[model samples]
Target: MSVSKLLSRIVAHSSDRIDTCKCVASSLHDHTYGITSDPLTQFACILSALIHDADHVGVPNTQLVKEETETAKRYKGKSVAEQNSVVLSWEMLLRPEYCDLRGAIAATDAEWTRLKQLVVNSVMATDIMDKDLKGLRNVRWEKAFSEQDPSEDAHVTTNRKATIVIEHLIQASDVAHTMQHWHVYRKWNQRLFEEMYKAYKEGRSEKDPSEFWYKGETGFFDFYIIPLAKKLKDCGVFGVASDEYLTYAIQNRREWEERGEAVVDEMIEKVKAVWEEEAETTDTFVDEASVSL
Candidate 1:
């Protein structure tokens, strides 16, 4: 299959978000970043977007690390999942039989280095559930913007910095829902919450979900996502669309909250059930191990 066709098939599982990403990529290429006009770069960006979270199991990196000790030890807490994805995705491009889209992406010395960095960082950032990773990203962004020499050519500087920043941009884009229309915002927020809650519940067997994990569809607008979107808008790098999206996010949170306590109760129950099941499994395992000894 052609790269675009492959992307379209993978996107069917995440049609709305992927379609939104395409629109964002086009707008960014034409109106915002201007770099996406390069077919190779555009392909890199789209491929990164399409594969960043492919087959995401809704599990957080930290949880994966704690549970899959061998995998964690192998990578020493590095991006085990993303690294696997990048290698697997690139290898897919190398099969001699799949030459249909070969060389459509540049494999030149400089271009390979740049595109690979972009793809790796973007995929790694999807582990938003890692507070350490998020903090590191914040620090890195602050350093990049603060350290860049504005008088020099941005392209002339080390591409590593530029690539990392673009990765941040893509991550911010994936999270751009907070800055969307209220109707659109609520739908995505719910999906994200469900995904996170699933992870949170799964982690309970090991430890309490980090205090940040929300147990209910409570006042998320007043408490979190809305304010977060506003903060991103205030950052100024994300442009005006992000600001508009944040406004709608606040509106969506309000509407969802108005749906009453029943919805919140249901969500909490679901999350709680996962925790309960995980605990039972852990206990049973412990009993088995003790008896074996």
Candidate 2:
């Protein structure tokens, strides 16, 4: 429901990833957990989750681009919400007031560099709707999981694996709603529909969410949610969390397929009534004020 919950999941996933890392991390020592073993990496992942949606405006990036808003222009129409979030939150973290906090996070120049890189990657990975980003993610996944040359350094293999894992870890956390229980999924799903419908009502969006929302959600489940959940399961790193995520994902998708249209209509009427109530409240306030004067 909140980014804080997402951060909690990030923490849980990172910990589980570490606990299970020895398997995919080239048989490293039982005490080791590859890149997550680095204290800074865990810090960076959690930090990324904390700030990933710092100023999200309940609208998708595509809507921002269509409107050509200042934020969209600033980010050149690419992942506008995500770029704005990173810049705003990252700059705040860099402020003088946080000098001590910054020091605690990164004591050395090398550590700062690694933390910044991981943070950027982790945060950006949340923009799963970006097509170019999806293409790149595929490449990264292949590179990280493919057979490594015997000549490659063991550390390099682990580092590659960890980087890709961190990216996917943050991404899964971003859409954790879709990978949760039916009630949780429905709650968040309705909220998202409300957000997009509000945008259409305000004329800030080109398409009416209701017209396509049910279909859109199904496609999303098939193409993005299920695959990502499966990735979590196949990676062999998230422990029981991955299985839970995938199972919930499939069930949510089924429920939506069976009853999504009814839900969509229900939401439309619900939002319409709320807006009507607000309009009536405003008109009554105006009438009362005029009479009083």
Candidate 3:
């Protein structure tokens, strides 16, 4: 099968909360299909979305390398998570069970090469490994949007536009929760907090993550989420989705400023309750299993 289809199957079997693939794919559908009808571009976007977080370990790359996990060693501490996601997903796609799907997506050698490169580049762009990502994006944006003449639109190469748009689309969708309605944003935020809190408890991260969760979210919205939403609108290919996202981002930031701390406390409490419940349930299962033994 193609990587995207295989990923969809895996996600469906494994539950949706494991990653952000569905959200990114839906956002791409919202942003790209209407703008460009090219099959390859659409396929590339879908594949990138599915594989971007293919095997996330609920911890950051920094922690992965610090712990010297297998993934870190495999990628040599360079974008460990992103590289693993791409490599593992690509391997699964090439397996014999999915050969038919692979053939469907890549009928020619050149087509296969292009598809692999697009998937790799698009997935790698989401790593955010350092401060250079923003600088590189700025340069790409300038090159893509600096045209003054109406006729110049036609001169823009398909490869250039597809690559830029796919990268931006994934970036925007990766954080789409930040620009969504307050309830939606809270749901995902709490999920993320729980993930980080789990890591903190396991000694994979520094300090208790809950202490700075609210403030960190506010800073993220101010510095990254809003600018990304604006950039999506500025790209001029996504129509009003970016504007709607921007509006929600501003409103959400305001909401967070007004009462975010209280919400964080509530989220922390909720997560604690859930974890305790799970622990109790596991203990009960173990007791029963032991009795049966």
Candidate 4:
């Protein structure tokens, strides 16, 4: 079985949340990018999305930084969620059952580098608040497409201009829902908001008194979505269908904003409930361990 299949199994064993990740991955591969040719690459992409949040514990990198968690201290605030997830994925990939995918990914040094960088880029892009990431990626993307390289080899070169563009493509896919069909965008936006609020609860102890998980605003669509949608539409990588898709996404987001806070409130309540249960279980475990010791 491929790593993707194993991932599905792992997700089935863990939680249904993996279902959302799989759906997003399939959408990105089929609908958004239309690059379903390479099984290995597609599998890698799915793995990137699936493992990106493995053992996530619903905490934000910022909270990890504030708490000085081991992962935060190790990655030095560089997308700690992404870095840890990638490492965990690599570890799982090395197991005997997963060796097939590992060998496929590491077939050549070039292939290894490409897969590693792609996974890193896609996973790291989740942190939209990283000001430096946006600036650095934009600079690299501008330099890359401006040069107009036609070679496949040129496109995958590590730490090069083309690498940046490819990374942005993956990053673009991560948030592609914001620029997709309205029905699709609304569903995904709700799911994403749930993820964010879950992260908020996991990080609440690290937050200031006045802080909330998310403010339920459309600022993300207005700022990031609008500019990136325009850029993608102009670039033409997504083809003619995407033009309509982007239009619907923007329209739907506006509608969502006007629909009031019902959906957002539901998401917040669900996350808080889950975290409360988790906290109780954790406390029980700790008490048991202390008594045993």
Using alpha carbons, what is the TM-score of model 3?
Answer: 0.79
Q: Which of the two candidates, 2 or 4, achieves a greater lDDT against the reference?
A: 2
Point out where model 4 deviates above 4 Å. Answer: 1-43, 104-106, 145-165, 180-216, 262-293
Candidate 1, superposed: residue stretches over 4 Å from native: 1-34, 107-109, 129-136, 143-165, 181-240, 253-262, 268-293
Per-candidate Cα lDDT values, in order, are: 0.58, 0.78, 0.75, 0.60
Scored by lDDT, the top model is 2
Candidate 3: residue 127 Cα off by (Å) = 1.2
**Candidate 2 segments exceeding 4 Å error:** 1-33, 289-293
Which pairs of residues clash in candidate 2, taking residues 3 or more apart in a chain or in different chains?
none
In order of lDDT, best first, we have 2, 3, 4, 1
lDDT of 1 by residue, 172-285 (tens): 556555445554554665566567766555453443433433434344456556655655454443444545556666665666666535445565676677768889999999
Query: Could you give candidate 4's per-residue lDDT for residues 1-293 as a string of tens digits?
Result: 22232222221111223448667555434332333334545555676756767777566778788888899999998888878988987777778997686675678878877777677776776667788987877776675455555564633532354244344445556676766666676576666666665554545544421134134346667777776666655444344434654685678667767663665566556666876899999999999999999
TM per candidate comes to 0.61, 0.85, 0.79, 0.64
